[model samples]
Target: MQIVDRIRETFRENAAMLREIENKADAFFGKKNLQTSLMQSITMLTTRWVKMPVTP
Candidate 1:
C-alpha cells in the first residue's frame, strides 16, 4: 500500500508540474501550439503509465 500511495503522490506532483509547464508553454508558444504539444505530451505520459509494471 505504501508503494501505491507513493505512486499516487508522484502523480499528483506530476499533475502540478504539467500545469506549470502548460503555463510556460502558453506564454512561449501561444494557445494553439501549446494545446497540441501539451496533448501529445499528456498522451505519451499516459501511454507510458499504462505500460508501466506495478506490483501491489
Candidate 2:
C-alpha cells in the first residue's frame, strides 16, 4: 500500500511538470508566431513603398 501511494504521487508530480512544460511551449510558439506576422507585414510595407513613385 505504501508503494502504491508513492507511485501515485510520482505520477501526479510528473503530470504537473508535463503541464508546465506544455504551457511554456505554447507561450514560446505564440510569441514566435506574432514575430513572424509582424515581420511579414513589415516586408509587405517595404515592398509597396519601393514600388511607389516618388513625388517631390
Candidate 3:
C-alpha cells in the first residue's frame, strides 16, 4: 500500500513538472520570446525531466 501511494505521488509530481516545462518552453520559443537555440531548449527541458529507472 505504501509503495502504491508513493508511485501515485511521484506520477502527480511528474505531470505537474511537465506542464510547467511546456509553458516555459513555449514562452521561450513563442512570439515575443527569447530566441534560444533548439539544442539549448531541449537540453534545458531534458535536464529537469525525470532521471528514471529503465524498465523492460
Task: Indicate whether candidate 1 or candidate 2 has the larger lDDT.
Answer: 1
Segments in model 1 whose C-alpha atoms lie over 4 Å from true places: 33-56
Model 3 / residue 47 / CA error / Å: 29
Where does candidate 2 have its weakest 10-residue lDDT segment?
25-34
CA displacement after TM-score superposition, residue 21 of candidate 1 (Å): 0.6
lDDT of each: 0.95, 0.90, 0.80
Pairs that clash in candidate 1: none
Model 3 regions more than 4 Å off: 31-56
Residue 26 miss distance in model 1 (angstroms): 0.3
Clashing pairs in 3: none
Summarize candidate 2's per-residue lDDT along 3-25 as a digit string, tens digits.
99999999999999999987887
Candidate 1, poorest ten consecutive residues by summed lDDT:
29-38
The lDDT ranking, best first, is 1, 2, 3
Model 1, position 51: C-alpha lDDT score: 100
Error of 1 at 29 (Å): 1.8
The C-alpha RMSD in Å for every predicted model, in order, reads 12.0, 12.7, 12.1
Q: RMSD in Å for candidate 3, one decimal?
A: 12.1
Give lDDT tens digits, candidate 1, residues 1-56: 99999999999999999999988988899999878888999999999999999999
Q: Name the Cα RMSD for model 1.
A: 12.0
Query: Of 1 and 3, which scores higher on lDDT?
Result: 1
